[model samples]
Structures are given as structure tokens and as C-alpha cells.
Target: MTAIEQGTAGGTLNATTARLDRLGDAVIVIAYIISVALYLRIMAQYMVGFFIPGGSPIWEPVIACASVALIIAIGIFRGFTGLDRLDRISLAAVLVLTTVLGAVLLIHDGTLVTSSTLRLPPPPPVGTLDALLILGGLVITVQGFETVRFLGDEYDAVTRVRASRVAQLVATSIYIGFVLVATPVMGLGTAAGPDSTLLNITARIAPWLALPLVISAVLSQFSAAIADTAAARGNLTGLSSWFSGPRPYLISGAAAIAIAATIPTLVLVTIASRAFAAYYAVEAVIAFRTTSGVLRKCGFALLAVLLLAITLFAQPAS
Candidate 1:
């Protein structure tokens, strides 16, 4: 072939690859949406358990089983269709919601440390076990932002950079603020207890806001689940040419739902958060190694260490 012809062919091949990548990203976004919805539905049932006089039967394992079934069905469908431009838009929407929610909480709390009025005691020593659990949980919680990478194909280089910057700012501001506000409000001692810190914080500020906060929390959790499933499916798509077929995607989605349903809502959330954090830590290390400048490398390293340290040491409010 002539040189110009060869070059033209190469360009076309690259474009095709790029288009496929974008499709995969869209599928991931769809998976995220489904997972998030299921999570919220399950959580809503759990929350109702607290207020209902007899508590609801829907909070049981049976409900979880049903959820899993639904997830699998949805995952399969999304996998079959592949990714698309609309999926990218959905992913962006999720990011925006996450950012806004984080910003709102940070502004509402107005501090980084725990609040005193929430009946919390002093925090445990920095390196103590309880401290580590709290810190670890927070780190895991914040690391959820890495889901962005799964949608890389859906974003152009500039969009990726901007999204990363926005996500980081929002995640950091809210997480740090919560840790600060929660530490004092619930005290180090109470923060180490079993109550949901997010709900507790909202309740303290305004009892009336509690229901709405709980509902929003459910929605957020569901969103995270959907994103998680989408990411998993996307990875699978890359692995198996067969996955490009409809059946495999459906099966994968079903499996995700089944697994989700089997696990307790709280346990699932905790696990998902921790897994995300661990993944983020790895990404941070990779960033550190890849950056050409010493300053950039050091900054990433510092952030990674800080995240790890917090995961290992901070206490959660009771």
C-alpha cells in the first residue's frame, strides 16, 4: 500500500478502537445506574425496619435474593447493548450528584472535626485499633471516586482532567469535613460505635431532615452499586470476546444482583467502600510512579499515604 493509504487505514483503525472504548464506558455507566437503584431499594427497606412498629419483613435475606436476581437481569441486558454516548452522560450525572452532595454536607457541617453537641467523647489515640477502623472506613468511603476510571473511554482527555479535579475536590472537602465534624459531635468514643454517621449527623442538625437524608443516602448507595457492577462488567467485556454477546452480560448482571442480595446492606456497603479505597491506593501509587516531575510524584505519594494512614487509624462515630 502507498504510505498515505497506509496512514489513512491506521487512522481509521484507531477511530474504531476509540469508538469501542466509548461503548464499553457507556455499558459501565448503565450497570452503575442499575446497581445504585437496587442498593437504594434495599436500604430503604432497612431504614423502614427502624421506624415500623413491627419492622418490615422485606429487610430479610429473601429480599436480598430478589435484588440479586434483578441485578443479574439488568446487567445482562446492559452488557448486550454495549456502551453508548448516553451512558457517558449518565455517568457524568452520577458524578455531579456525588460532588454536589459532598459539597452540601461540607458546607452544612462547617468544620472538619467532630461536633461536641452530638454526645460523642474524645477520639481514641491516633494509632489505636478503633482509630484505624474509623480512618479506614473514611478512606474507603472517599476512594469510591475511582469509579471514574471505568468511564475513561466516555470522556475526552480534557473532560477526564476536569472530572478528576472536580471529583477530588468534592470528595476531599466532604470527607475531611465529616471527619472533623463527626469527631467532635459524636466524640472519638461515640464515633467508634455502630450507628450510621451520615444519618446521625443529619439527625443532629435537624430531625426533619433525617428522612430526606436517609432517602438520599439510599440513592447514593444504589448509585455506587450500579457503578460497581458496570465497572465489573466492563472489565469482563474487555476480557471475553464472548461477553460482547447478550447472554454473558445478562448472566453477569444476574450474578451481581444475586451476590448483592445475599449480603447484608451494611456489610455490602462496608465491603464496597473498602475495596474501592484499596483500589484507589493502588491507583495513587501508579500515578506517583508515572508522573515525570518530583513534586507531582511526591504529592501523589503523600496523598496515598495519608489515605492509607487514615484507613488504618481514624475512628468512626457510634
Candidate 2:
């Protein structure tokens, strides 16, 4: 073929590949949305008992087991998929969620007043458990870069660099903004409350916002689930390629998801939160080890320590 013709053909092939990769990423995003929706629905139904129903007994062990199982399932999946377009969508959702949360706090001006005349109990103390849950959620919310990294081979260098930068900037700004709002609105004391203070704060200030926020939370959770599931499937695909069969990996992925769904929703979320924290910690260590950069290493180390402390110490809402 002529040189010009060859170059044209190559360009077409690159475009085709990029399009396919994007399609696959979209599938993952859809799956994640489904998963999150399921989780939120379940949580909403049981929120009162799970948080603070007057006479209900706590089911900490069951909840914890479910949480661990869900996390393990997601970890296996995310680890398998690495980073991709779905991860980007998931990242965007997180950024948007954080922005809304920050806005809610800003609008409320750090106060926790409700329009209704019902008397509310004081906020809970900042026990280890509360700290862990908040910190863990924040860390996982920003861990989309890892997903991007996994899909690195599929994109050109320029695309990779641009995507990474955009994700980082958005993630950082939202997180910082959220912390600023959270600190004042749900004082450290109130933040430790059994209920999701963030959600409660929003509900109190504007009941209309609650339904939509719940919807968004559900969607975000589902997106995360899709990212996790796709990751698991991709990992299995890699393994199958090495061993010359896709069946094993396919069966494994299906089994994992099935097991996850059977577990209680609250348990799944808690476990997933803690496990993601640990996984991110390890991931940070790996990054540090490979780059040998002191600043990056320290930052990751700190994240790991913070997540671990939260997981081990966060007090369950009674």
C-alpha cells in the first residue's frame, strides 16, 4: 500500500478502537447505576432500624458481614477492570454529588435547622467509626484515577493525560468543598450521628431536595457497581487469555455478583466502604513504590493509615 493510504487506514483503525472502548465503558457505567439504585432502595427501606428506630435491636454483625462481602465483590471487579471510560463517568457522578452536598451545606450556612417544629436530638460524638466512614467514603469517591489507569492502554497518550488532569481537578475541588461544608453544617458532633447526617441535613432544610438527592445517590451507587463488575470481568478476561479459556473467569464473575446480591444491602455498603479504603491504601503504596516520590508516598501512606483507623474504630450508630 502507498504510505498515504497506510496512514489513512491506521487513523481509521484508531478511531474504531476508541469508539469500541467507549461503548464498553458505557456498559459499565450503566451497570454501576443499577447496582447503586438497588443498594439505596434497600437502605432507605431499613434506614430507621439501621440507624435509630426506638425499640429495634442492632444487627451489627450481619451488617458488617454484608458490607465486607459487597466490598470484596466490588474490589475484585474494580481490580480486574482497572481504569476505563465507565470509571470516568463514575468519577463525574461523584464530583457532582460532592458539589451538591457542598452546595447544601453552603445554603444552610453550617446550621442544622429544620422548617418543621419537631424537636430533634443532639448530634452524635465523633467516634472512630464515624470518622472512618466519612473518610473512607471520601477516599473511594476520588479513587477513579485507578480506574483510568486500568484503561490506559486503550487510549492515546494525549487523551490519557487530559482525562487524568480533568478527573484530578474535579475530584479535588469537590472533596475540599464538601469537607468545608460538612465541618460547619454537621459539626463533628452531629456528623457522628447514627443517621446519614448529610442526607438528614438536606432533608431538613428542603424536603423537596430529598427525593432527588436520593435518586442521585442511587444512580451514583449503581454507576460504582457497574465499574466494579466490569473490572472483575476484565480481570477474568485477562486470566482466561493466559490460560486459553474464558469460561473460568466468566463463571467466577457471575458467582461473585450473585453472592453479593444475596447479602443484605446495608452490610454490603459498609463492607464495601471499608474494603475500598484498604484497597486504595494498598494502591497508593504501589504507586509510591513504583515512583519512589517522597511526597506521593507520604500522601498515600497517610491515606492508608487514615482509612485503617476509621475502619477499625468507627462506632456504630445505636
Candidate 3:
């Protein structure tokens, strides 16, 4: 979608199509901003949960506000490249940690037992619509790859395509492998909620792994949020003169902090998913019009309708 928009024949589409494309761009930019904020909120939760266990709810809000302030300040003074090195290092650490987490759980399969401190809850029966809603909500989990589309300035088209493919393959493999390996030990964690399950599971299998896991989680989230914020700013500034300065960053940061203080993480997850769904639905329409093959156009049309449904009906996990 981004490639089509940034193509050489810019705005050559009919005026109505061009208008819709711009509208999609605006939606995408806004959605990315919210996603960055939500990432910071989740990162703040990790910090509080690890460093100040059982801390007051007020602490998450305070930390989130401070984090956004730091992001905005660094963005204004140092630029997005300031954190490039750290982001790379943390991203590598995350990949390594995910590998180790899965391997360790697989190796310790025989020793795993039901949690004594926090019992795993039973799954409730879900109907078809409810299941679809949950699946839609989880679409955000498979994000980040699309961000590669916006990195054309840093990487050539071929490089971006390969990177996107490799990212999806690597991340999806890790997710699937981790899920398969950790199935037996799912009941071993002593978590207060879903967000802290990985940390608790880490502690259960290898006590020594807990601290590094938290550190990696913290760094990865912070760096990802940084990347998203920069992406949002770049897209917004490019789209309109009104967002050409620090206004985009400032406004989005404020909105994120406010949302962090008020909304539950689960709710934020669903909202973020819907926001991105809207963006994708719009992009699907753009693709539908631009492509040549009848079959391909039909596929895009179906995708647009499906994503539109998700945007409207997706629900957070129970």
C-alpha cells in the first residue's frame, strides 16, 4: 500500500481516488501514533511489574508520562537515529531471548507443573463471532513488518522486500515454536494477568533468566515505541504542513499518556487493532483499484470488506 502511494506516478489516479488515498494515509499515520503510545504503556507496565512489584496503579501512568517525555525530547534533540544502535542491540537480544525461552521450556517439559501461586484459568467456550473478534484483536501481534514498507528511504525496494519477508518468517516461527513448546508449561506461571505470564514462566523454568528477560522486554518495547513515534511523525509531517513541526510528536505523546492512565491494556490492544484495520481496509481499496488482474482485484476487494468488519467488530480477549 505504501509502495503504491509513494510510486513515481503520484496522484495520477483520478481525483476521487487520490482523495481516498490521502485519507488512508492520514488514518495510517494516526493509527501508528496510537500504536507507539500503546507500546510505551505496555513497556511501562513491564517496568513497574518488575522493578516495583505490587506497586500502585498510579506508578504506571507516571512512568508512561515520563517515558513519552523522554521520547519526545530525544526525538526533538537527537532525532530517530539517536536510538538506532540501541534498537538494533535490543532487537537482537529479543530474538535470542525468545529462542532461549522456547528452548528452556521444551527442555524442562517433564518438570513443569501447575502453578501453586497462580492457577491457570479454564478457557470459556466461544462462538464463531466471538472467536473472529478475538482473532481480529490479535492482528496487532503480527504488526511491525508493515513498518518496513515505510523504510524505503533507508533501504532499497528489494532490500525492504527481503527484510519484510525475513522478519515475518523469523517472528512467526518464534511465535509458533514458543506456543508449541510452552503448551505443557502454560500452567506453571504465577501471573496476575496475561501480560506478566512470560515473566513468571521465565522465573519458573530458570530463575536466573528472569532479570535479563525483563530488561530485554523493557528495552525492546521502548525501542519499538521510539521507532513507531518517529514513523508516525515522518508520515504526518509529510502528509500536511500543519504537522510539519513538533506538533505531531507533542500531540500524539499527550494522547498516548492520557490513554495509558485511563484505559486497560486489553482494551488498548483491541482499539489499536481496529485502528490499524481501518488503515488496512483503506489500503486494500487502493490496491484493488490499481492492480490489473481480475482475480487479484477480487481478492483485494474481499480483504477490504473483511478488514472493515474487523475494524467494526473486533473485541478484546475475555
Candidate 4:
């Protein structure tokens, strides 16, 4: 969707992101549902393990539920303005942490880099199911960037284009920088855990940075999830007027988060990442099938299959 929106000619179709059909929207909703579930669950766990120490264990549920609920309530009551506030808060945390960490890495560690694969249990033979699943998890790590596409034409065309470019560049740079510094300092083991990556690394190098980074991660995930939840909810309601009311969405959203948070989950990072990859594949297929030209349609269909194939080697999370 982002690729199409950003003027990437997809297959033979002059793909238009603006006129997404119901089916495309529905599949996109599923991708968001699973992605947000994985994000919320991991974030809640991070908070429980780090910030809310020495309290009655009951506090775990409260913290987790409250964090998810608080954002939902904000989204419902405050709408776009509330989301903006959440985005700002999260961004502030990100800016501060990135600046300090980048400076620290350069000064304290000097030039260094390490492969996250260093400490990994030897991955199953390449092309195995385990390897694919692991690679999927790695893909999920950078999935948040696609959320930018949702911003759409909210700004003037040129402004949106420039802004998106700048944002992606900044995001890629920071992520690469952080990984370079963090992998060398903490190794693959620290980041591969179920806990938040920032929380784990900061705990070692900058204890003082831990609290704010965790808060930032939790808030960021919650905010993004709520936004995704609302998108999913809108699609559901659109499917049938019988699914009307904010009540239904609120209940379902909470239930999904709770289930995702408490259950003995699988390789969620892998699951969510592949789900998005699948979502993209589906969109491409839709584009191919809908295109007016037979040649373009076949080209897109082939491209779609190729994209799906590449998921087999996406470089799994460590």
C-alpha cells in the first residue's frame, strides 16, 4: 500500500492506493490486528519486568490492561488530537534516547559493530520452516515504519512526499545506528528476548535511560495499536451495519490485546512480520487481478509471487 501510495508502479497496474477495495482493506486490517497484538504483548511484558518491580503480582495485569485501555479511551474521546499527543510523547522519548545513545556509543565504544547472529543458537538449516519464521520476526522489527503511509494526503502532495522521505531516512539511520552500537555492546542475546529491545540494552549501558525508554516504547506501541485497532474496527463496521457501535470495537480490541498479552504465545515477532509480508503479497495480487491490461496483470501476478518467495529468506530476528 505504501509502495503504491508513494508512486511505485506495481506490476502492470497503475496501482492506486486511494481506491482500495473492501477485500484489500480487510486483509490489511488482519495484518494490523496481528502486528498490534504482538507489539502490545511484548510492551506489557517489558513494563512488568522492568518498571513495576516489587509490587503485588496483580499489578502486572493492571499495568498491562491500563496501558492498552488508556490509549483506547484517549482515541475514543479525543480522536485525532489525542493520537497527535501520543505521537508527540513517544517521539520526544525517541529523540532524547537516540541522541544520548548515539553520542554514548561513539564516545564510549568508539567504532565497533557486531553481528546479532553471533550468539544465536545455530539456526536450523537454511530454507527450513524455523529459519523462515525467524526471518519473519526480524522483518517485524522494522514494520513500524509502514505506519507512515497512513498519514496519506493529510498534507500537501509535495510536503507529504518530502516529509515521508525525511522521516524514512531518519528512522533508517537511527535504527541502523542503534543496532550497530547495541549489537556490539550487548550482543544478539539482549535484543532477541521477549522484552523490549531498548529496555534491555539501556538497562546495561544507561540505567537512568531505562525508565524513560520503556515508557516511550509502551506508549508508542499502545498509540500505534489503538490507531490500527480503530482502522480495523472501521473496516469491521463497514462490512456490516450490524457491527455498529463503538462498544463492539472497544470490547473486541481489549479482548484481542488481553489474549495476545497473557497467552503462551509463539514466535510472535515472526508471526506478525510474515503476516504483513503476506498482506503485501495479497495487495499485489489484488492489483494484478484488477488491472485493465492483461499483460500488466500477469506481470503483477508474477511479481506478487516473487515477493512472497523472498519472505523465505527475510533474515529473521535475533
- Best candidate, lDDT-wise? 3
Deviating ranges (above 4 Å) for candidate 1? 1-46, 50-120, 124-130, 178-205, 247-251, 262-270, 281-285, 293-318
- Stretches of candidate 2 off by over 4 Å are 1-105, 110-142, 182-197, 242-256, 262-270, 277-285, 292-318
User: Which RMSD does model 4 reach against the true structure?
Assistant: 6.3
Could you give candidate 3's per-residue lDDT for residues 1-318 as a string of tens digits? 444645536745566667777887788777877777677777878777777866558887778778888888777776667655556777888877767767777777644443234334455599888988899997777777777666656777778788889988988887788777766566554445433366666776788888878777777788787777777777777678998667877877777777777887778888889999998899889888878899999999999999999999999986
Global Cα RMSD, each model = 8.3, 10.9, 3.6, 6.3
Give each model's whole-structure lDDT. 0.52, 0.48, 0.76, 0.61
Clash-forming residue pairs, model 3 = none
Would you list the rank order by TM-score, best first? Answer: 3, 4, 1, 2
Per-residue lDDT of 155 in model 1? 57
lDDT of 2: 0.48
Cα shift from native, residue 155, model 3 (Å): 2.9
lDDT of 2 at 144: 53
lDDT of 3: 0.76
Using all chains and alpha carbons, the TM-scores for the candidates as numbered come to 0.59, 0.52, 0.88, 0.70
| RMSD of model 3 against the true structure | 3.6
Ranking by lDDT: 3, 4, 1, 2
